[model samples]
Target: MLNLSDIFAPSNQISNIEVNKESAKINHSLNVNVSVDCVVIGFDDKELNVLLIKRLQAGDEKAYSPYKLPGSPIYMDESLDDAAKRVLVDCTGLKYVSLEQFRAYGEIDRLRRAEDVQWLERTHGLASTPERIVSISYIAFVRQKKFRQLTETYQATWMPVSKLDDIDLAFDHRQIITDAIRKIRRDVEVQPSIVFEILPRKFTMLQLRAVYETIHGEKLDIRNFHKKMTNLKYIVQLDELEKDVPHRAAHLYKFDRVVYKRLRGSI
Candidate 1:
């Protein structure tokens, strides 16, 4: 019923409000409590180890006994992988390490335990501990040489995985490591490259067997182990022998990458 002039009048016009670009870009409902946890596995001197970092308390300069898995909250501008790599560098001073996501844990009580809350309070300076944490856990196999690059001190200790039960790890890390172990065990049976990471590029059969036994957590029959390895086409036995050793000079061997690629699909 209104006239065209009245409808188009400046007095009746609705103006568009100017919005602050930064304020308009904010996402309040986005999950910012997401974090990444790394279960770093390494082998040295015929023993398998897991990397655990000692977190210094925020208030007390002297309290630094409690060890926890290397982790950090995902940053606003970084991808999850970048956040994980940052955590790895922060903990081990190593970069470009291979990592694969193993699990995503989202529980209301993931960070609600009393010990977890206390540790978060003392170490992280969190005014209020997050009630729920959604963490993406990753597993990495660190070569012995790469592991040696880490400056081992009270701050960053490489404890034998077998002895993890004796040590009290912070947060739900113990369970996460347990899950990673199970996954690695399954992976090693299928992928020979995993075992290679724990040993030198050129290693004796005895050294290889020791690595396997350490990861398997049980003694393997030497004869059966040899027989199974001999049947594998990818394991190339070299004419080269050990040098400058206290023990006998055993023949060395290495896995052939070309053969492994061809056989990987079948395995």
Candidate 2:
């Protein structure tokens, strides 16, 4: 739906990044066909958000509006895990993000679309785009407020998951996001501690319940939720209260990882 030529062009910043990549190489560098894509999920009180990127400008070309998950071709010198981390930092300007590899996406017709193929050819300057690209995907659910420093070679934006219908994403990124959400749901079921990864260090009980309700897509009974939370020995109540809020301050609670691990060991 967007012009490919307009969306991608030779840029100064990219050349800088290339220099950094080359600095590590002593000889001619060879790259594998694998690429790394990251799905960074964040939670607001009411809904979930996803970190997406789009071209900053098309220069003279007509800029497109569609976005893509932050990713890039992996370096031969780096492991997949290291590639995920490096690509995230290079593409998204996120200094740190702890990612877990969840899936590998490589369809026979992965680069069948004209826009996608053109994107590959333009950005990577491939004379002939590869027929297939194996995407090693990584995911992370982290506190949004903690990582506000996000910018891609293009630009990064946090869009809500519920409103994803509003814009377009390149390639099979939509499917990738769905898979990440599905995995998060399954992992939360097996280990409730996974939910804490998305939350702040100190949180309110209502805020905790909100995260649960948003993930499950249903309202929870407040009484039952509170009662069950009381049994979480690792959820330590604190004297601290939420500051500068419109409503009454609620006492905060912190997760005790040591207690949680010890309890898990005993059980």
- Writing each residue's lDDT as its tens digit, candidate 1 over 93-160 gives 66777888889888677775676676654444344455676899988877656656664433677778
Predictions: Cα RMSD each:
11.0, 6.0
* Per-prediction TM-score to the true structure, in the order listed: 0.81, 0.83
Model 1 lDDT vs. the true structure? Answer: 0.72
Name the Cα RMSD for model 2.
6.0
Residue 39, candidate 2: C-alpha displacement in angstroms: 1.1
For residues 1-267, write the lDDT of model 2, one tens digit per residue.
432223332221232245564566532132426788999988866678899988433462444436889877665567889888987787778867889897999988777778776676556665555568899999998778888887656678788988888787888888899989888778888788987877788999998998898787689999999989978999989989999999999989998888988888753
What's the true lDDT of residue 215 in model 1? Answer: 78
Stretches > 4 Å off in candidate 1: 1-32, 58-65, 151-154, 264-267
The lDDT of model 2 is 0.77
Q: After superposing candidate 2, which stretches have Cα over 4 Å from the reference?
A: 1-16, 20-32, 56-65
What TM-score would candidate 2 get against the native? 0.83
